[model samples]
Each structure stands twice: as structure tokens, then as C-alpha cells.
Target: MRRLRCPYCGAVFEVPKGAVYAVCPYCGTTVVAKTGEEATRQYYYPPRLDDGEAFLLAVSRARMLPGAPADIAETASLARSELHYLPLYICSAEAWVEGCEGAREEREETWLATSRLPLPGLEHGYRFPVVGREPYDPRRARRGVFHQPDASPEPRCSALRARVEYRAAGEARLAGCRGSVESRAGLVGVAHYPVWLIEYHHPLAGQPLRAVVDAVDANLLYLEYPIPLERRALVLGGAALVLGTGLAAAAAVGLAAGSLAASILGGLVGSAVAASPLLATGLSRTGRYRYRPPRVERLFIKG
Candidate 1:
């Protein structure tokens, strides 16, 4: 076992070099990962909520939102809540993106423009203001039985850095220049964010509600629940009204312009657009529980 020193109590202890974070045995303080380059340390807050508490926490917060169904907390059934810890490498880096202006016009020459953009989905690319390699707050030691985080049997970190860099470059490229961008990490550390996948059956409509909650702060990152039948009707009706109005206007304009084919085509296209939304809404309401995906970004929280 390799020996690592605890910055909090100044105690030297044995730990695996590959271990990113560990609780200091001497002081009971959480020790965050340190790059081999630095003498200083950092911190990460693990899931204070335990497996047994997972379902309870989710239930308690289910209907807490301002517009939540009144019976969501009281009558909604908590079908299941599973624990997952998603891996992320949080880093502070120096990145410079260099891409020639797609078409830059000088004072007397061509054209130039640039812009900035991007981030990722709910479950994945969770951009928290979270930091790494910091000291653990001793006062944060709360009582709970934390389960071992589920680890993928396959390798994952192999391409993590590359993926991060690729995203960084893509951001620059999207801003309007087509060129190469490179990033060098000054400090990089891994942390697993705690998440809970909770399944619920809403009481009002008895529709299924799927939710993903951030176990760390109990943030409801994503939720898909039934829209009440009344609300569904409103959506369908409003969509139809809007589509009819738009098509009527288009058809009138085409007729005034003496184009029968244009008017007919516009009406047909409008009819299809009007049908699509209602079809989706109808399909969702077909079963006892509405068809819905639990999370916005399927790859984010689970992975």
C-alpha cells in the first residue's frame, strides 16, 4: 500500500495510488484526490443518504415543487429507488482554441465572425460548481450507511480526458470558427456524484412518474409525470387551433396569389402538423401509466 499524508491531521497513512478519494483513518475527515504534482489537497462530499433512505427521501420531496400534483407525496406510490454514482473528472485547465475565421473580411477584404456556446444533458455532464482536491469539512460527517458505488466492470477513464477536450474544442467551433482547439489540464480529479432513480405512480391520474434525483443535495434534476387529462386536452385543442389558424392564413394567401397547388399543399402540411402533437399525446395517455422517460439526458445520471 502506498502511503499518503493527511493534510488535516498531518498523519501519514497507507492508501492505493489509484484511489481518488478516501476517508482519513486518523481524523475521520474525507480526503480528496491530489494530483501527483501538488502538495496541497482537496475534498469531495459523498452521498450522505443511504440505500434505505433513498426511497424515503425521494418520496418526501416528490410533491414539494410549487406546481406538483397535490397527492403526489401522499398518494403516489414509490415503486423503486436505485442508487447510482456517476463518474466525472472535474478539472481546471488552460485551453486555447485556434480556428481560422470561416470567412473573415479585413477592412478592405473578406468577412469575420465568432461566438460562444455549449454544455451537456441533465444526467450526464452535470456541471456543478463542484471542485476537487480540497480538504474535507469535518463537520460534514453525518450518520448514514453509504452503499458501495456501483462500478462498471469495463474500463471508463481511458477516453475521459479526450472526451472533455473534444467538448471544449467543439464549443469553440460552434462559436463560428472551424479550427483546432487544445486543452491542458492543470489539475484533474475524479468524483462520483450520487443519484437516485425513483419510479412513482401519480395519484391523480394514476399515471406513472419517473424521476431522477441528485442524492447529494436532493435536487430533482429531471421528472416525467402524467399531464392531467384536462391539461392534455388543452394541449391538443390549443395545438389544433394554432395549426388551423396558421393553415387558413397560408391557404388564403396562396389563393390570393392565384396558386391552387400552394394552397392545397399548405392545408395538407398543416393537417399533418396538427395531427402529430395529438397523436403523441394520445399515445402517452393510452396505458395506466403514461409513456415517459425517467430522465432528460438518459446518459447523464445513470452513467
Candidate 2:
């Protein structure tokens, strides 16, 4: 047993010799008796939306997007929702890359590539414009009732992120140089980002559409779009009608010229021209779906 003296009250107490940290029993003062690398603190931003509000927000978003079925927000029921803290690699380092000219190393260019980590299958594909955010200490996270995601990034994911970081550094260094460049990463650490996962079923889409929302500001980051049955049917019918017309015209022309092969070729061309409408529609829909503005871009439904 070792006697520990309270710095605040000067009260002496006995604690296990192996204990690294303990609280003073008399004055409720914290004491640290160990030395080494300090542990990194995890944090979680308080979510504005609870279970109910999150569901409503998702529905409202659904209603605004074009091509979304009318009353989908109201009619579509939420099947499942998840709130989790996604880990990110917050790197603060500089790369010393070698800038080469022709076949020789020209000079050393120190390039700062990027710090934000990637959350694949999530917003911006990679973390973009990840600035200005306040986080609460995870140890005191019980200030509000919110779910914490238990899933963590595996070791392989860390390796992938490191590769991305190095590649980005190399590309940046090369871009600044004329011929070639070499890059290496430095300081990096693990961080956490909070997100809301909402899964709901709508009539238009046979499967559920998953929407990933930013828990802090309630912004929709990534949404899986689905095409309705009616649209699919229309696209198919329209394409078939045009193709059939093209084939018939080609066949007729070929028969008149006494060449069976010519007729087949003409039919193919006719079908393509007929299907132009479908192509145009598809392109238009694709452009709209990629629109990122929450207010301006009404809907982003993808089939």
C-alpha cells in the first residue's frame, strides 16, 4: 500500500501501489500517478434530431425532390434508423516530396496535401470542406440521449486511408512540378464524425432508400436514389416502340433494294433514332439527381 497526499486538502489516503489514477476521497480531487503518452479523447457532437424528428426531416426531404412520389414522406414508413460516430483520420503533417525534372531530381518541394479522411460510400466521396465543427467530450456524452455507433474502422481501412493520403501528397507534389515527384506522409490521428442513417420504404422504389444525414447541422450528405415502377415501365415502352419502328422501316427499305442485310442495318438505325427520347430523358434525370443544393435542388432520385 502507498499513501497518497491530496494536493487540495492535504488529506493523506492509502491506495494500491499499482494504481495510476485515483480521486482524493476527502476533497473529490483527481490525481494522476502514471506517466506516458496521454490518451486521445473521443468526442460526439449532440444531434439536433431525435428518433422522431430525424424521421420527419427525411420525409420532408423526400417530398421536395422531383420524381419523388407524391405523399411519399407521409405514406412511406421508416423501417430503421441509426445514429453513429464515424471515425476519420485527422492528419496534421507536411510531406517532403522530391520534384524531378526530365530524368533527374530537380529540387525538394515540401507540399501540404490534405488532412481530412475519407468516408467511402459517404458524402463528397471523400471528406470535403470539413471545417468549423465543435465536438463534445465523449466521456461526458451522456448530457443527452443519443445512440453511439459501436462499429469501428478496421485495420485494413486505416491502411486504405494511408494509401489515399500518400497518393494525394504525390499528386499534389507532381502537379506543382514539371516532370516527377515523390511524397511521404507524417503526423496522423483517428477522429470521429457523427451521422444519422435513415432507412425508409417508399411506394415508387421497391427497396428502401438509405439517407445519410449530418447529425450536427442536419444536412443530407448521401442518398441512395431509386426509380419508381411507373417510370421504369414508361422508359421500357417508349424505347421498345421506337426500336420497333426503326427495325420495320429498315426492313422495308432493305426488301425494296433486294438486300436482306441492308434491311437489318436500316432497322438498327431506325430503332436507335426512335430510342433518342429515352436517352434524352435519362440524361436529363441524371443531371438533376446530381444537384447538391438542398433548397434549390428539389429532388435527387436515382434508379
Candidate 3:
């Protein structure tokens, strides 16, 4: 038997052994405890950190960026309003590669290259745990410390599984030489990973950009790019018109000069013109606002 807490109404009750689903007594919500082959993993919230301490730590982490917003202090202050442990699923897998050697032989002043390579096979698998939805509530009590929510356990786990599989396949392709190899795979139990959810309100863009930072590993999982509407329109639109005109001119010049030379120049110019907007959009996401976790003590206090 397991004790389950209702996310909607905050009711707690024991789920009987062999029972796969339970109806919430307070809210009448049907909560599924298991799905097919996946079993639900339990999670416990970490003890809240002191307000001053959390704020200092967040600020320190915020400083690692080269061009973080100037009012990061105020943004960090707003974080104090809510805090809760967020759940996440984590996994790691090993990858191996093997292959053959190629050699060259010279005889009678003639060079000959002999290459014999065996096809390589890669074997890897990922395990994931289902995390129930209770811990995802943004309004959960923080026990007086700043608590930033972590990734939803289900989605994060799903994404991690996909990443592990995709990376294994990609690594195999990159290693041209091939042979059979084996690797270890591991999965982490349900746990609340620390994160700093930074919401940025920029002057140029209407909506704020959200960024997630891993608390323990200090890795950036999700980051939104800030798009400057006016700048994008001007730069992109102007570049397109200019590049188009240049291509037209080159085509005309090629017809007058030589068809072959003009065609080569136009093709090069056209390819560059086509690739410019993508490069510009990539560059525009540089300036973003930063948010960090708040102190636990301050969150529970009434304003």
C-alpha cells in the first residue's frame, strides 16, 4: 500500500495494494497510479534553503553570464513569491565503437590501396520511470525557502531517453570504422532536481523569455531566444531585397559576360542570401533576462 496525495484538493489517502488507480476523495479526480509497463516513482521535497543564502547563491550563478540584465536583483526578488521542489527523470548510457585498419602497398613504382572494413553494430537501451503529476503544481508550499520548480518528470525522462538513443545512433555513424561493442546503461529514480526558472521581461519583445538552469549540475536545459521585432524586420527584409537585386544583376552580368561565369556567381550569391536570415535569427537570441530561485523563508511570508 502507498499513501498518495491529491494534487487538486490536497487530500491524502492510502492506495491499496494491487490497485492501479484511485479516485480523489476531496476532488473526485481519477489518478492513475501505473501505466502499462512503467511504475510510478516517489519523490520527496528538499529542505528549503535560507532566504539570504538562496538569494546569494542565485545571484552568484546569475553573474556567470557575460551580459545578464541589470535588474536581475529585482527579478530574483519576485521569485520569493513561490517555491517548490520540481521532479525530473535522469539517465545515462555508454557508447562504444570499433573498426578495421586500411593500408597501402607500392610495387614496381605502382601505388595500390587495400581497404577491408567490417560493419560495426551498436547496442544500447534506455530505462525511464514515470513521475506522477502531484509534484508539478506551481502553487505548492515551499516550507519557507525559495524553491524553483524542476522539469516535469515524465517529459524530461522521455526527452532524455530520446536523446540517449539519438546520440548513440549519431556516434555510430561518426565512427567510420566499425566492430561490435557493448556499453552500460543506467536510470535514476524519481528525484527533485534543483533548477532556477528565470523569466525575462525585455523592453523589445512583448513576451518574456523563460530559461531553466540545473541546480546541481549547473546545466542549461531550456532557453528562450529574445527576438527584436523591429530589428529582425529591418535586417531580414532589407537583406532579402538587397540580395535579390544582387542576384538579378549577376544574372544580367553573366548573360553579357559569359553564361558560365554569371551562373557560378549567381549561384554563390543566391546560396548566401538564402542562408542569411537563419544566421541572423541565431544571433538575435543573445540578449536575454535571467531568473533564479528565491529564498525559502521569504516565500511563505505574507506581503
Candidate 4:
């Protein structure tokens, strides 16, 4: 490994041997090590939330969940709060197609860079900031842990160009009759995005609950809260009551109608109709309670 000073920020950082691109941690500048050396502008999203604000938001979210204890927001303790800066590469492409009818130009499309720890939200339609990003400052660097990219930017940049070109060409072809298409990849740069990993304790839960929040927008990406026992028991008790009443109604209907089919139909309808509310509540509570998968839980807390 060798260390080099960033011409723009004057921050000295290390790069692996034979690496084609190195991103400056302090300034978000990328240095190209190709024949004609070059530098690309990069930016980092500033975090709008602090640990206290994030914890409050988490508690608010937890309290809003169905079957959550009413006082969870007040009683919950903030166990941990960490800010993380995830890296991304931004790439764009422009394509034009010419056909017998006319020529059309497809709008420029962009592909954001991905990393090993891009996290779940990025892949599941979580849009990263395309605007309102600020240039990295030394003071900002001290705010959180700026994760280093696992791989050089060259590979991701290349992949981005390829992906954009292919997608643009495909869209152009689909828009009109197959024609000659010209596509060119545009600027590729690096960015560090901010996120918050928060862990909190609730008396209802066995362990600390984890929440992933977007530091840029102060939005919750992921959260987990336990269902209050009283709520669950109340729902179950209502269900039982409805079920018993339905059974009695079924017997009455059968005795009045004097038919087995009528009795069965009455029983099924009564049970379903009377218990619909409780049944729905139970299903919803159980489903939401079971929503936290161990893998995802570990990813946010342990990863």
C-alpha cells in the first residue's frame, strides 16, 4: 500500500497497490491512477438527525405500532446510536436512436454505485439522495464512522456504465422500431451517504430492538417493537367470546330450521361474521410481531 495527498483537500490517505481509484475520506474526492491522472468531484450527505432525535423518532414509531404498550415511548431506553456513512458511485448514460419514422433521444439515466454493505433499503427501492448533497468537510468527518469501500471504484464504475448503456439501449429499442442506437457513459464519481443504527430497550421485549434510520432525511428505514401482552390477551379473549356465542347461535338456527346443512351454514357464517374483527386484529398483530427476521435483526445490530 502507498499513501498519497489529495490535491484538492490536502488529506493524505492510503491506497492499495495497483488500485485504479482511491476516494479521500476527508473530502470525498476520487483520484484516478490511469495514464492521464484525473480527479472526480464527490459529495457526502449531511446527517439531519442526532442520537437524541433519532431515539425519540424510534420511540415514536414504536408507540404507533398496533398492540404496542401505551407508555413504551416514555419507558423505552436508548441503548445505542451510531452514525454510518455508506459509499456509492454515481454514473449516468445518454442514448439516441434513429429510425425510418424519426429520431428520438432517451433521457439520461443514472445508476448509483453499490457496495457490500449498501444495506437492505437501497436494494428494496430506497432512493439515495440525488440532490442537496454537500461537499465533505473535516468537521463532518468527525461526526460518524466513514466506512471505506470494500473494492476499488473502477469495477463499480465500469459496471455502472455497462448497466446504463444496456438499459438505455433496451428502452430505445422498445420505444420504436429497432434502429441504430448510440449510447455514451457519463461522469462516474463517489459519494458517502449517511445512515443511523439505533438500538433501544423496551420492557415488553426480551432484547433491545434495532432501528435503521436515514440520517439524511430522518426517516425510519427499519424498526421492530413487541406486541403488548395485554393487547394480545384481550384480542384472544374477544375471539373466544365470539366463538362461543356463534356456537350457541348455530344450535339455535339448526333447531329452528330443522336441517343439518342449514345448521352447518349458520355456524360457519356466525363464527366468521362475529369473529371477523377479532380474527383480523389477531392476524395483523401476529403478522407484524413476527415481521422481524433474525437475519435482518443481526444485519442492523451486529453488522
Error of 2 at 4 (Å): 28
List the candidates' TM-scores in order.
0.45, 0.42, 0.33, 0.59
Model 2, global lDDT: 0.49
Across 1-303, the per-residue lDDT of candidate 3 in tens digits comes to 667776656777665555444444343333454432223442333433433444445444544443344445445342332222333334444444344222111111100000111101101111112322233222442332222122233443344445554444445555454455444444433334333455545454466545544333443434444444454555556566656766776777778777958675866677576756544653574543333333446443221
- The candidate, 3 or 4, that scores higher on TM-score is 4
Off by over 4 Å in 1: 1-80, 95-126, 131-183, 204-208, 215-219, 227-231, 263-278, 286-303
- For model 3, give the 10-residue run with minimal summed lDDT: 105-114
Per-residue lDDT tens digits of candidate 1, residues 1-303? 467666667777665555555445544443553432222333445765664465555556544432344455566667766655443334443444565433221111100000111111252334443632234354653332222212221133324445555555555555666656554443344333456666766655554556666567655556555555665666567667767777777788888989967886877687768677564654454222222334655453211
Q: Report the number of clashing residue pairs per model.
A: 11, 4, 10, 0
Candidate 2 wrongly placed segments (more than 4 Å): 1-38, 41-53, 63-67, 95-120, 142-185, 201-209, 217-229, 235-303
Superposed by TM-score, candidate 1 places the C-alpha of residue 149 at a distance from the truth, in angstroms, of 11
Worst 10 residues of 2 by lDDT: 105-114
Could you say which candidate leads in lDDT? 4
Record all residue pairs in model 3 with backbone atoms less than 3 Å apart, i.e. clashing. 86-150, 99-178, 144-296, 144-297, 145-295, 145-296, 146-294, 146-295, 146-296, 198-291
Q: What is the overall TM-score of model 3 with all chains considered together? A: 0.33
Candidate 4 lDDT tens digits, 35-148: 214354566777788888888887787666656667878988999988877766565555555562333333322234434544444444465666766666555554566555
